[model samples]
Target: MTLKHTISIITFLFALPLIAQEPDPSEAFWNRLQSHCGNAYEGNLALPEEDESFGGKKLVMHIKSCSDSEIKIPFFVGDDKSRTWIFTKNNGILTLKHDHRHEDGSEDNINFYGGTASNTGKANIQFFPADVATQKMIPGAATNVWWVTLDDKTFTYNLRRLGTDRVFKVVMDITKPISTPEDPWGWVD
Candidate 1:
């Protein structure tokens, strides 16, 4: 073969690995969130102001634990530490799961129901549509879409149920850190 062709093939072979590595938008988002690791932020409901349970409660989110592939964020509505937002990443894919537990550290029936990212979203946001697991776990939740948006000033967790009038959004001010709350339900240490 000609030297020119041989060199071209050699360069292409060297670039194969780089080309095979898909861009993971989740990594950037994860790192943005990880920047707030070990910190807590206080926020309030921004969408519906008439939430009976979350209306007057002090809503706090603690970036309790973080790892290379997962982040555990405990969301406390008043004294109820039963809700946690679990963000897990595997093979460059991201999934969001809700971990619900009772005060006794027992799993709730409606737990771990969340979705996986349908695509590698932008740096500031990623959308997670209800996965099959969520559809099987909750009736009528098949249309749910959850997303988290993070920036230097704020972190927002949002949910929108397709074909319905249900939407939930919580905006936390990351610019100001709050005292980390206690361990969430079922959390050791």
Candidate 2:
């Protein structure tokens, strides 16, 4: 074969590895969420009989803060601003926790209960089952499972209580992000 053709083949082979290597699913999921940082979206309860507190109330989710390893999203139910969903990444694994606060900025007794992803989920989805802390904090929640899914048009947060019929889901439209909402309780700026 000609020298030029031989050189081309070698160069192509050298680039093959880089091209074939796919991005880590956790990292890709983080990036997808970070893309919506500083924006807010409105949604409604999408499953199993909404509670009275959340029913008839405006629901909003703000991707308020994002960093390389952590993200804080405040979920607003009407004027109650005491809930924030926190996502953290470490060692190729992702964890999801709920931060609940009082109006005075103090944490609630039943706060920070969540779970870690058991594996590197797909680029658009991750599942978190009840962790030790969650089980201890809320015994009834020991069988809970939560998952988040993101796609080109929508982002959904879901929950299911295994051994029971309880379920909750909220879907946000990524195509149209609204203005940022007021700061969540205990969060300044």
- Using TM-score as the measure, the top candidate is 2
lDDT of candidate model 1 versus the reference: 0.90
Report the C-alpha lDDT of model 2 over 96-148, residue by residue, as the tens digit: 99999999899999999999999989899999999999999999999999999
Per-candidate TM-scores read 0.87, 0.89
**Compared with the true structure, what per-residue lDDT tens digits does model 1 show for residues 1-189?**
999999999999999999768556777888888888999999999977789888888999999999998899999999999999999988767899999999999999999999888777877898999989889999799999998898889899999999999999999999999887889989965
The true-versus-predicted C-alpha distance at residue 181 of model 2, in Å, is 0.9
Count clashes in each candidate, considering only residues at least 3 apart in sequence or on different chains.
0, 0
What are the Cα lDDT values of the candidates? 0.90, 0.92
Question: Which portions of model 1 show Cα errors greater than 4 Å?
Answer: 1-23
- Show the lowest summed lDDT stretch of 10 residues, model 1: 19-28
Name every residue pair that clashes in candidate 1: none
11: Cα error in model 1, Å: 17
